[model samples]
Target chain A: MKALLVAGEKSYLNEISYLLKDDQFRKSTKNMLLCYHSINKIIAKIPFRIYETFDCNEIGLFIGTSHGELETTKDFLKSIGIDKRARPFLFQHGLHNATLGFICQTLNHTGPAITVSNRFFSGEDAIDLAMDWLQLNKIKIAITVGYDSLPLGLENQVRGLYPQSTQLSTGSAAALVLANEEGVRKILNTNYSINLNNLFLERITYCRTSNARTGGSTSTHYYDSNAIEEIYNNLSRYPNHCSTMNLQKPNGTYSVINMAS
Target chain B: MIASTTPAVAVTGYGVVTPHGLGIDPLWSNLLKRQTCIANDTGTGIIDQDILEQLKYSLPKDDGESASCGREKSLLMALYAIQQSMLHAGWTSLNSDDGLIFATTTGYIASWENELLGFLSGSRREDSFQEAFRREPLGTMLADICNGLNFCGHNLLITTACSSSAQAIAIASDWIRLGKVKRCLVGGCETLSMLTSQGFDCFKLLTRELARPFDKKRSGINLAEGAAFICLENESTIVDRQRIQARILGGGIASDAYHMTAPHPEGLGIYNAMKIALNDASIDKSEIDFIHAHGTGSYHNDLSEGLAIQRLFGEHSPPVYSTKPIHGHTLAACGVIESIICIKTLTEQILPTNIGLKDRDEKLKINLPLEHESVALKKPIKFILKSSLGFGGSNAAIVLGGIS
Candidate 1:
């Protein structure tokens, strides 16, 4: 409907099961919403969004990453006046593929939301997987979500790769609404390859920041100062290299490369 | 049965970032001198002093620069390892559509969490991974290494604890063997994490000093961090020029159906893993020259692993050693790292001594390379077995062979 799909030649979701439908790859809905309280919460929240209200043909596809987050939608369930299961369905659906199950629970799309990941590119690869399926005319709409709550390993590897995105050590969540379009923002037709040489690193330069939602930098030097020269010249290497390296080691010092501006 | 015998996959290259050191030069050099790549970091990921103040033993930190810190922000190592492996696999000389299979248990979670925390706490500014794959999502870790690398294949993330990387390699090998992929770059990455330190500490499963595995005095494990990758190809495409490290005989996966954290205690799942692996390779347990066991210096695991080996090998169990104490438990990286180590041992014809195993545990009478003694094998050993058992009773064992 909105996003046109393009795909690489080879992908798991490309092959068709029958001449009629396409196969989309996902993170898995194996344990979608394990209990009933979460189901009550879902039932309660059913009124707010247009997704839940509609009969569901226009928006051809809907995908969600995980079902549960910090707040188990507990209050909403109580408001709906429903009983919680012995084991919270919120927690069960709270596992990885709960959201997709939620969509499936509501909208009757006969297609499948296949879960998959190798690490890192679950989101993009999931999109690619869906696009490959689309090329095979798997489905018309594609919604992809790449989100993770704090897992056991998240805290340690942060100092090295993603030193900027963590907020209270919470997991990252990303979802994109995509559709197989003949004349739209093509999701397919792009040559996707994982190259070691093409790794991208983001550099942030603060611009006259005032308190928005979250506050500004505490470490003054790289604060909201209006000077690009300081960072461009690399005039001073990072001052706090404390949490950068071997961050996994117990008390391994974070390096100066942290909070890099 | 899921894997093809005499796999078409060729291990083109390997990359390692561990306390044993990062890069091939340091790792190989340390191997020759028989030195250990262990060190201390006092920076930030873990407040060693603070934890020591609270917990009995000091916790490991993210020291990306220290030998013990080999697995942090060093994207160059990943690049270098890939380059070196490609060169060795003759991949550099030729161009092929081999996919890169990057794996990690703690894949950049440490770096990502702290930075995001700093941002959320109103301490720092910048939205890296969030910004990178705004439309999509990225890393399981705090840092977005996966997006950073820009992988576009059937990118996979296998996080079954210690078996993470090995499973990645196995799948990559399968992709090539099954012709699902041409060539595959397979490996794993893990950095130290304070949370992991606290989690392990909470579980009371660490040693005060450096780890001492397989020793009567072995207390607990020293959790290390890092990454390692090996390039693999189809044998039909590769000529038998370079001496093989160890043939990847067979690999098998089976769930314990037991516990979330503990092994079956009876070693049921692990036993089947080894047996299935041997059978898949069309080899017998007796043919195994040596075994690289996942001897994390824990009470239940060592005994369980010992039982599994005894059950499989009976009286003729080959020499086995766990390098955990030597290079702390590298978590997910261990699968590929240990496999590479097995390759190194097979190619060099040496069964490395278990670094800290001075004395053996009384109840466990399994063969361990406890000392720095080299065995002069008259001929090249064919099969090398490497096993990795993760939490949730997930067991995976891989057999590597084709030694000439």
Candidate 2:
């Protein structure tokens, strides 16, 4: 299928806009989502990864999934009274690779669509791998979906790994459609970057019991503590070198309240 | 070698552990004989009766908890696989400078899942979770395996869904080529957990019998659990005595960006992944002699995978076989272990038959290997494409060719 990257989840956009309404972003919208999210975050959870990597308005081909997505397609389609017979259409797009399928289906185009995950780097890896799909010319359009949600299981698993930190934050990711076009998301013009170094980020632990005991009244999001962006920023700059960055969190769940697009 | 940055991965060795087959030989034999391990559950010793009763819908109440096995079997299988692979590659030892990329969708999840259910039921306390919640986790357990085996290296966990192990292979290959690690033990491991079986049961997708992929009468998948690892090296990295099983030439991953639980109705993602692999290896589709399809055997899965095959190779998809019929679905271990089979098949030219294709789907027009067939390539082939699709929309295709 043509590498058609069209749209991505809107949750992160909502979060980004919510963040944009904040004071820090009002003065300099220069980087917009970049300021809020990392190149990885913006590209990964949103349409940023494939935004500039592919020709958006051409041959339709998309690839992505909303990991435990907040806005589930099943419920949405079902609410609208979508045909059970047409449900495969719903299932097709709902597949973790559905982001790509929808791009193809909506673009009124028929092409290959693939969805894969290495858990966290799915968006990044998908973009890199998708770029390699083209033979004769740039794929018509490649939509890359890099969205994430808090599966209760993943939260507990990651929490067990990093227990000093508690609470789960669900994220909605998006990115624009792309093809053999151009964009400025990349430092070097490429769809995605592969970081294979065994960089061990230090335990930038924030310990507080009150935070765990309290609920929404003291909710904290990944964006609030800026841990997510901090992670990418530190990792990207240092490559394989580990860095420990600390930030405090008030009591509450790491809400997906305000973040990058 | 000025840091070959391209994605040319090599598999020096591989290991496996499963109920049907304890290691490669046993697993292989089971695959050949179609000996399924799915049956009435016996005590796996991981759960208790109360929780079992709570999860009533799931059959084999005494059966395999295949879904979460990534967390369960990964450690043991990883150590086993890493040990064998290292021995095969002749790297009897390693120091701290090496690296690791262990992949799994759910690492230590079976433990965590069960304990969490206990926690919710108030039977377990937070303090009891100390071991399960450790930082190293199952992934770190792999690092420990490296250290125990005297392979010193960096350890990183790659957690993609079903494509996890394949991604581990791809990523490790890239690292070796980049001169990051002289060698890396890359693989995915997982184990059966109560939660997984229950979850599948909740979805009403669990098959009580051994899974039958591509079979017309196949009901659903029979989840199994296990681990597999490979010692991957570069041309000049290090030498070991273990047989050089396979060299990873090319592989690609595609995103359907579609639904969370189904492949594209048209099998588009599968096609893209296939095209990427062929282009990556610069091999023609016509050259493929065998295809180890990610045929989970669920009606939907087979149908989607079949359509994908048609879309990519068009009518003549290579002689195809799905090992799930034999070993059941090994989740994270599926790719690595299956790749080992592909590598073995390529080396010996012995393609094991699909053990469980009882009733064939008329719509599935591809040639299904129902019996062991001599590898009938024009010559000792250079490439075999393996495909995998995950629970959510995840698909990975990797190509392995002759080591020579």
Candidate 3:
């Protein structure tokens, strides 16, 4: 089975504040704000008539994050020590899945929803799970999102840990709307290629190496919150040829995603 | 929906570390007696320090100096449960193709809180900074277990609030059914910390008294700490069928899309979850013998879940019970721990009662076992349904069938 990336959106730290000006985003928590805004942007990019034809129950949402809601957790914890009381709102929103709830509620999606974390590979993991659901016929369309926000102090600490790494500083979010073959033919029509761009329908295969040392040392080290978007950009640049991206961690473990046209 | 031709996933062995005691024997016995392990003063179920110390000494010493260092309580509890499960499965080591999935709502929060508080209080600032730099990613826990057990297949950490482990189990079952992996070890571990306690307290969701699910005057929930693991294998992979405890028929997950902290008032999402689960199992509602409800004792949670059960089973509803009052609510680990209870129930043909139910809430209109009224079925219990609902409107249900 193949998954076609139909729509996508992304947001960085500077653009996030502007995206939160909408009324729908006013009530969202800090982490939820980042994800909701990016998803909202994706929805806005799709044609309204086509989006209306999709069934909410057939849409699945998968989110990946390293330290979910770290700012809210820190704030809530500090409040307990200083004020001798915890803020209920912050506490409720600090959960890793809280962002899933907010996005599902806004979209009225009732299909399978989950949050997965594997450190730097979280983004790839989310996309892989979405593809699995599509291949297993569990859902017609899958919204895969990768989001993370690092507070200033924590960012410095992480930087000190990996001085060679440059992608661990800012907060960012990216989302993609993927559709199976049947969903694409039914919802967008077989002649629907005229409207969408960068519609790469490709087969995905995942392989993991325990000892990166034996893998000939060609692995790319990318650990940003928008790692999925980065991979997409690289693959899209070489659309005429089959390409592979290997995401490696400091440890010897790494995941290789082979995308074939 | 799952086709009948889909491969069956079997539960080969399971283990747990809860406040009642280590292993499943103590928990099963206490549950049969309808006893609550919630401490009187703390109003929470906490594992004894003696048991923890015993577990610490029991760790495998082959990992060198790193094994003796101060490990997080969650990791220690998970290791103990995993060790017991692997031993019960009669495997000295895991295959390179075997997988491991860990679930947790709060990962290493207690340690993070300690370091942050020390830094904020102007004490041990330099040490706290250094510790933060040395902190490993949450996936490191899963990697640690895999390296120790020689498991090299897929590994994932799921954190979807209270239903975390249930979803993990569902995903593992899918992996087995789809031929992605032959065997998978799935479990969850949670440690009681000030973050969860004070956080729930702020919402007035924490109870000062014992939790009373389905009771008319039920208070809130008691926060607890625990860990549980279940080893799942493809039916074809099992050489000795006698080791099979139960067969995982099917599972389903759904979202309410309703609220962040509160469930849908009418339990629409939960009803969908249960209905989907039955369909996935390719069985009718009449086939289920009982339900293991996610009864957190909170007014909204109990009422919503009860209403959902009534809607689904509709007058012929089988017996329903919650073991939360016994283990108090273990958060992310509740799903797996309660599932172990369900497995034991199926194998032993004994149905445990709800521990603290006094006056049933007439509004629910669902059948619930009375306090101290555990029952041993005359006929064999064939199918059991387990349900879990979480903070983010995440609902999950799985069907487990007794090995015939």
Candidate 4:
């Protein structure tokens, strides 16, 4: 594993209120604001020089939402079939790519922005997409985000899939700005683009059976929050140390983020 | 940005399930006839209605799992297409070394909608949630295909608005070029859903009447559904050269970031994508014989694409046409479906006419063929550029040429 650029992270939707509680909030619709809030929270943390050095066209964004804007979809459909009043705003904001599109527009970033959904591994998928693009030299800077709200309209339908104790909250999101390790000493190894389940199983087996250390030290941390913030925040704590954290999403997918120095 | 000489990706086999019918022959023949297939969707909100009824008179009764409901139509169509492509390529099985990348904007959305409607009507079943959960993840769609085919390989599902499958194909080619995989199955699948129909209607992006691309009075897009897949292999992996339909020379993708729904007025992203594709192919702008434009009949798309074409080809532009009217806009599936059109055009020496363009937009400077023509030329088509622009300002272009 090599050192990777760790730009920033966002743990909660409320943490982004600073970006959303402005005059722009007046003009935007509800879902639009929600999306912008989530995206803005991440990009706002990236160094200004990163944006300045790379042309907006050279930056990419990969976002994953398990149930993308379900409320908006439900509202649009219900309005059309039952209420007989179509809200164009809801329709526009309901798309799975709506947040990705908004983020591009917000930063004027022209590089390819992709939206991925993989049940519970959406966040890991976004990270995988970013790492692939970065390693391929497809983009200089990649902004990866994982966000989802409680399926308000379809809650009762999907709740059974989750453990009853799972705390699936509304407006939960996390972001990571990943870049190539040109001169940076810190590295983030995603072990990306592999069968995530098999990889998780292999890692678990290795951890349980092996006494070998990957780096000078090895440690495992488990966080209660699925925000990915814990991983980001703790990466700095273990400088020059190899660490791996397995995050269990409420939807039962384990997202493993590996960091090595 | 053109790299040194590299191996070209060959399209060995293709399968298309379009409104015209099953098989590439049906789609090609219909396109050659210049028939517009757009009609008022009668089964839009009905869950049990076979959305692909327009494809044929009736489907087989004993097809078993092959029979598709509105929601499963995309997967079923994709499976059929994949079966055809694999057989065409003379492959018995795909192991872990191969790759499968598919794209779609809607996966089981119709089923979820039905569940929602049922719940709203107080007719929901106890297992409705389980059924919906099973179909919720776009990844599950990939898993279903993988398990059904017994494929143990790297599989990726991309959803980049309208250009999802196009990007998927481009990435698959990149993977093959980079030696990440020996062979790749690339394509897209989409099934009609009320969410898309009403959503597009709300955006005013759907035309009330028939879709008319590049027409002076063009209104909006006509929504359609279908699935298409192509087997791509590099020169090293290609077993029989005779089966090569077309070769992917190069591809490029760019984002406009100008607007979410609207494109850059000057078509900067479109121009960049085409330019990069040409550069990547190491071909001059003059070598392109034809363009399969992403003319969705929307005013902004036509204007932007026309301007981009004018800026690139200037005086000696090749014939440009849109197949959206024939197939309606298949959304994510347009990339592979349109690429198949290009392959057929090169293979059969036939150029499809641009339907629904009675009167060209004089304001937009470009040549659109209103009548089908045979390319019975002295030589095969050397290069054809295909372009697809999506809702999020994502633009992708690929340069394809004859295998020879």
- Highest DockQ against the true fold, candidate: 3
Worst 10 residues of 4 chain B by lDDT: B42-51
Off by over 4 Å in 3: A21-24, A48-51, A189-225, A250-253, B64-66, B372-378
- For candidate 1, give the docking quality class from DockQ: incorrect
lDDT of 1 by residue, A1-261 (tens): 113311111111112222113132232222222111222233333222224322222232222232122123222222122332222343323222234434443433323333334232233344444444343233444444443333232223332333354232233233333344431222222332311111111211111112233322222222101111111112124332222211111112111111221
Better of 1 and 3 by lDDT: 3
Query: All candidates: CA RMSD in angstroms?
Result: 16.8, 11.2, 2.8, 6.2
Judged by lDDT relative to the true structure, which candidate is superior, 2 or 4? Answer: 4
- Per-residue error at B29 for model 1, in Å? 3.7
Q: Name the runs in model 2 displaced over 4 angstroms.
A: A1-228, A231-261, B1-8, B40-74, B129-154, B236-243, B371-381
Recovered fraction of real interface contacts per model:
0.06, 0.10, 0.73, 0.55
What TM-score would candidate 2 get against the native?
0.65
Per-residue lDDT of model 1, residues B257-300, tens digit only: 45445677767667767876787667877788888899987777
Model 1 achieves a DockQ score of 0.05
For each candidate, give its TM-score against the true structure.
0.58, 0.65, 0.94, 0.85
List, residue by residue over B162-263, the lDDT tens digit for candidate 3: 989988988889888877777889999998887898888888888879999988999899988899999999987788999999988878889888988899
After TM-score superposition, the amount by which residue B187's alpha carbon in candidate 1 deviates from its true location, in angstroms, is: 0.2
| Residue B51, candidate 4: alpha-carbon lDDT | 32
Report the number of the highest-TM-score candidate: 3
